[model samples]
Every structure is written in C-alpha cells, then in structure tokens.
Target: MGPSTSAPRPRSCGAPSAGVMIPHKTKRGEAALARLKTYEGVPPPYDKTKRLVIPDALKVLRLQPGHKYCLLGELSKEVGWNYHDTIRELEEKRKEKAKVAYERRKQLAKLRLKAEATAEEKLGSQLDILTPIKY
Candidate 1:
C-alpha cells in the first residue's frame, strides 16, 4: 500500500474550546433533575405576574444559570408554546388577563363580522348577468 488516502478521524478528547463548559451536577442537583424530569410540559411554574419563576425553576430543574435561556428555548420548541398560549396558560388563574383576552377576542370578532358585511354589500351591489347595459 502507498500513502494512506483516508482522512484521519477527529479526536473526541480534544481540549475545551473558549466557551464555558456545562457545570457538573451536584448530588442535590441530580435529585432535582430527577424530580423535574417527571413533568411532561412547561417545566416551571409561573409567578403571579405571568412570568416564569426562573431561579426556582432552574434550581428545581438542576440547571445552571447559564443554561436557563437555552433550556427555555428548547422547552418551547418541544412543547410548541406560542406567545398567546404561553401567556394564557401562565395567567390562567388570573382573572385580569382572562378578561383582557376576552375583550380582545370580542373586538376581533366584531372586526371580522364588519369585514364580512362589507364584502356581502359589495357583492350585492354588483349587477347580475342579463341586466340591461347603460348607454
């Protein structure tokens, strides 16, 4: 055989890159992760202001502070919680947000009805076939 033509395999045990490494879990963190993993969706409980309880969530989830943003992003992707759904779910227990959402929904319904009525009026005004043509 002449010189080897195949490229060398990349090293798995390479030195760390410039970015910070993931923190190793402590005993408590391991236990917390186990507990948090039991849930199916939206890992944390929301606070009264309809925001996620980040610190508490991370602590319970056994995630480092640096990983919070990424965790939430992945969770949203996996759970498919859009803005309105998230807001509604987070504030589900709050009457104020529910009332606000109800008012917005009513306004949207009125707008849709008005649009439909306008479209019907325009269609009605159009001359039907066989009508006498104006000179």
Candidate 2:
C-alpha cells in the first residue's frame, strides 16, 4: 500500500503557548470564529471619550492590560475591524460571565445551607408510638 500524504491541521494560532493550558476549542468556539470572520466590515463613527467602537474579532482576542495609546477602536480601523462586532462580543462575554457567577452563587448557597443543618435535622424528627400488649 502507498503511504498516505496529507497536510497536518493547523493549531489555533492566538492561544497561549505556556502558562495555563486552555484546550483548543473544537465546536462551541465555532460561533466566535464565525463572528471573527464576519467582523471585516466597517463600524460607525464613535466618540473617543465615551464609546470606543472596535470590530468583533479584535474584541474577542484577549487584550493587554493598559496603555497610554489612543482609543483601540480607531486603531482597529487600520487593522480592518469595526464596532458593531465589538459590541456583539462584549454582550456575549457579559452574559456568559453573569451566568457563571449566578450558578456559582447558587452552588455555594446550597452547600452552606446543607452544612448548617444538624444530623438529626437532616434526618428529620423522631416520633414515639405507644403499643398496648394483651396478656
């Protein structure tokens, strides 16, 4: 049999090479990818002081902490990203984080309440029944 020749699949480029190991997303991340691809369109004009609009792809990528640089939205224009996609990404992350926080709170509350109960309380109260025996 002839040896099969095929090109190796390319791993996600932007993912970190060291530190925390975030596995390559296979399916759920597809939506984000699609959004990233669609973010090539231009975003509307935005005031630098208030709302800095950027394209969706740039927003999805993890950004550096701080810089004295100009509003990133303006810079993103040169890179071909726009603002509406940026808003979409922000909304997605906001909802995702809120849901996770809510679930975590619910779990912690459940654990704390369960721990506060005594063994007897957890088992329920005991009731005595009297039976008469005939001789």
Candidate 3:
C-alpha cells in the first residue's frame, strides 16, 4: 500500500512546530475578536429628572415596621433600640419559618418515595406473570 496522504493536524496548545507553520493571531487581534463575539444591547440612558419620595413611604407602601427594615433596609426610627430589636426578631422568625418548611418538604418526599417503592414491589410480580414470554 502507498503512503497515506492526510492533512497535517494543528497542535492542541502552545507554539506550533516547524512542520506546521500556522499563522497565529496576536494578543490584540485575539482580544478584538473576543470583544466582537460578546455583543451587549445598549440600555436606555437613566432619567435624572426622576425623584423618589422617602418620607411616609412605609405607610404608602402598606408594609409593616419589620418589613421596612427587612425589604427596604430602612429603619423605623433614625436611632433607637426598638428598631434594632424589631429587625433582629423579624429576621430570626423568617429563618425559623424557612427551616421548618424545608424539613416538612424533606419528610413528605421520604414518605412519598417509600409509598411508591411498596406499590412497585406489589405490582412487579403480578405484571411479570400476566405478560407471556415469547421464545
């Protein structure tokens, strides 16, 4: 058989050998190509004329004193122990509620899986017997 004629393969990484002199893109050219590939849509410019009303905002929003601290990061009073205490208590209550919900979901999943496994075990034998084997 004659010598196999195949195209030279490019190096996986690093500088190419003398046998295959492939033209490599410069650092600047590579960077330009990368920038061209990553296209980002231009967002509308911000309107400086817009104004936010802060005074009595909580009352307007219909949010609780605790929610104001948690959601908006705005304290009930400028400086007082009551505001700090309410924020801390609210955060702790939320954490406890989240943990309880997670535990409930996990327990329900385990019960469901056990029920499914038992059902499959009972039906598996009956299904195998009902279906006739073909030789």
Candidate 4:
C-alpha cells in the first residue's frame, strides 16, 4: 500500500466542563453568577447594540503551531446536544412568521382595491341620476 491519505484528527481534551467559568470566591459572587441567565440567540433588547468580540477567544489567535483543536460547539455535539436540529427548528419558525405576515399584507391589499372600486361605482351612479337626459 502507498502513503495514508486520511486527514489527522483533533486530540481529545477529556470531559467537558459545565457552567460559566467565572471566578467566584465569596458566597455573594457565587449567587450573582447563579442568578445570571444565559440566552441562546441575541435578545430583542440587544438586537440594535453592537456585538463584542474577545480577541483571545478568536480561532486564529488561540491556535498553536502544528496543533489541531476542536471548537466548543463540536464538543457540545459529541456530548449529545443537537445544535443543527435546534438551528433548523428556529429557521422554520422564522420562515413561518414571514409567510404569515406576507399573507396578511396580501389580504389587506385585496380589501383596499375592492373598497376603491365600490366607491367609484357609487359616484358614477349618483352623477347619472343628477344629469337630465336630452330627448
């Protein structure tokens, strides 16, 4: 056989750690960390705000020479979290919402056109009645 053509796999880093990695020495700090809620996507309140990026957490900056590393998302998938499925579900919901809004706008436009046609017919009839016919 010739040389192996398979790509090198990332090194296993053992079991994943749970919860946020905040330094909490005091009881109050622990309580505050516990009280903080984590959101999956950006919330409506922060939608307009600019997102902050940590330079240290960036892939290019954190990567070492000749070392392969697996991302946290990849590790989560190995732990049985269906990240792709969740994203698919969210996309479906968003499409459904847009479809419903489009349908509502179509119905409103139809109603508006019908109302305009009825008004024009009523005005034409009144004008015919007011004008006298030449014998």
Candidate 5:
C-alpha cells in the first residue's frame, strides 16, 4: 500500500492556545478578552484583598518528576513575549507598594503620638482645676 498523505492530527485540541493567538471578532468576545487581559499589579479595589490559590493548578503540584512540560510563560517568551521585563515591572510595583505602606504607617504613628499628647494635656488641666489652690 502507498504511504498515507493525510496531515497528522494534533494530540490535544482545545481553546486555550487559540484564545491567546486569535483576536476576538465579536464585540462581546472583545469585551471579554479585554476583561481577561493581565494587569501590571493588583487593581486598586483588589490590592488589599486576599487572592485565591488553587492547589491543583500550581505547577509544582501538577508537574510530575522527570516529566517534560513547558510553562505557559515560557511558551509565550518563545513566541517573542518579553517575560523578564514583565517580571521586573511587577517587582518594581511590589517595592513601590511596600514603600507607600511603610510611609503610611509612619505617618499614622506620628498622628497617634500627637493625639496621646493632647489627651495627656487635657487630663493634666482637668486635674489642676480639681486640685485645691493653697496660695
């Protein structure tokens, strides 16, 4: 028999890879894609909120020993995505957030000290008024 000429079929077929490469054609699809776009850092509203972690979705847990697997990020980098720059930007954002939080805590402590001092003065003045004047 002659060799078959049909194209080899893909091992797996799903939307995950297509979703990354294809542009959304419909308005609804475009809007959904926009919503799904990655943000540089946590959004303002979610900055202080706890993030959800799925243990099953973790790479360390999902990958078996000695198994070959390419991470999504790695694949994106292979396809010309600047992975390192994105990581650096994220690290910078985290540092900036930490600095802002430290400054806020320092300012709050100063305000609290001032409040305590004013309270003490008020208490001392009240005690003076209650005390008998011997002069």
Candidate 6:
C-alpha cells in the first residue's frame, strides 16, 4: 500500500506496537497453526510437480505453438513439446500394468499347481473305486 514497485513484495513481520503478535500459547494461535502447514520451512500451497497426460499436453502445446515450453528451466526443447509429467505418468501406468500382470501370473501358477495335485489324487483313487468292470 506504500508505493507500487516492479519488484516482488518482501517478507516483513507485524509491528510490535500493533498488538499483531499473538502469543503462540493462546488457543487462537493454536487454531491458526493447525490451519496452516509448512514444508521445508515454507508455507503450504507450494509449487510442485504437476501431473498432465502427454496427449493432453501435446494438444496444449499445439494450441499455442509459440510460447516456449521449458521443464524445470534445466532441460531445453529436446523433449517433444516439453511434456514433463506425461511421460512420467505413462511410465507409472506401464509399471502398474506389469505389476498386475505379475500378480495374475502368480495366482495362475498357484491354481494350476492345486489343480494338478487334485487331479493326481483323483486318478490314484479311481483304481480302487472302479475296479475292472466285469460284464
């Protein structure tokens, strides 16, 4: 509210005379602390890795074929359309599918083993139950 400047606002604490420094031991302060969360000594609502599908990202890039898409400001345009989270999500999906496939294979192996054991047991008992059927 002082003067408009091009630079971003700097962090400043409340004035001691304004009674803004509420004691942390108070219930109101505890409630306020519960409402706020910090990570890495920073407040919540942090910038994080956003998830986006590759195809959808491609569509976004194609929609605005001018703005240069950069990833973490480190890698350049080497990746097609700079689809960051899309490839990651796809890889995760692939791994999930593989894991499910492995689990199914394991279950099938167990079922097959059980079936084989049961069949062997029935065959061994068949000779005793159905002796030579004489006419």
**All candidates: TM-score:** 0.26, 0.29, 0.35, 0.38, 0.37, 0.34
Per-residue alpha-carbon lDDT of model 3 for 40-131, expressed as tens digits?
11112322123366876557566655653332223223322134455556657666766787799899999999997897788887767655
Where model 6 places Cα greater than 4 Å from the true spot, the runs are: 1-81, 125-135
Evaluation by TM-score, superior candidate among 2 and 4: 4
TM-score of model number 1: 0.26
Which of the two candidates, 2 or 6, achieves a greater TM-score against the reference?
A: 6
How many clashes does each candidate structure show, in the order listed? Answer: 0, 2, 0, 0, 0, 0
Candidate 3, overall lDDT? 0.47
Best by TM-score: 4
lDDT of 2 at 110: 90
- Candidate 5, residue 18: lDDT: 48
List the candidates ranked by lDDT, beginning with the highest: 5, 4, 6, 1, 3, 2
lDDT of 4 by residue, 1-135 (tens): 135533221122222122235556678767766666544433456543545799988877878878977665456456554554675566577667667877998999999999978877887867576558523
The segments of candidate 1 whose C-alpha lies over 4 angstroms from its true place after superposition are: 1-93, 125-135
Clashes of 5: 0
In model 2, the runs with Cα more than 4 Å from the true position are: 1-81, 119-135
lDDT of 2: 0.45
Whichever of 3 and 4 has more lDDT, that candidate is 4
Candidate 2 residue lDDT tens string, 1-135: 135633221122222222123323746454445444212222333211233556754734545567444544444445444443666576576667667877998999998887756643654534112113312
Per-residue lDDT, model 3, residue 103, is 90
